[model samples]
Target: MTYRLKYGTGTEAVHDAMPSIESEQLSLALAAACEDPIGATEVYGEDDGVMRTLVTEHAIAVLLVGRITKTVTVLQLSYTG
Candidate 1:
């Protein structure tokens, strides 16, 4: 299974605040979530980019390096599975 952000379909405002790297990480995280919707983690923001993280069933944690940015603040996040 694969999950991807429904980009190019939403208002331009979302993209306006998201950096390229953040978008990439968001996409990857979305995909990972599809494989395991129950997965959840605390995501961090940096240099204007987002990151990907997941908590496995074993209670282990995995984090993926994401983009960095200086602009584009994340106002809110709505999780959907």
Candidate 2:
């Protein structure tokens, strides 16, 4: 099943403020995560499948993958480019 993507309270605003090209790259990365969360993201710290991160050329997204809910929630986003 495909996971639904959701942003944390202030994360959407952060995403909106990113440069357009970088934002698009992050969007595509998120979409890939939604389609295959485990395959697309790396474990943030531990090997736990839920806490993962998606990294793009310019940005890194911290995500919480909820297997029960089939959702990928963006907990934090950082733009480095």
Model 2 error, position 26 (Å): 0.4
CA lDDT of each prediction against the hidden true structure? 0.38, 0.94
lDDT of 1 at 16: 45
lDDT of 2: 0.94
Q: How many backbone clashes does candidate 2 have?
A: 0
Candidate 2 per-residue lDDT, tens place, 1-81, comes to 899999999999999999899999999999999999999999899989999989999998899999999999999998887
Report per-prediction Cα RMSD to one decimal.
14.0, 0.6
Residues 19-60 of candidate 1: C-alpha lDDT, one tens digit per residue: 666545664554555444334345544422144444332222
TM-score of 1: 0.34
- Model 2 residue 35 lDDT score: 97
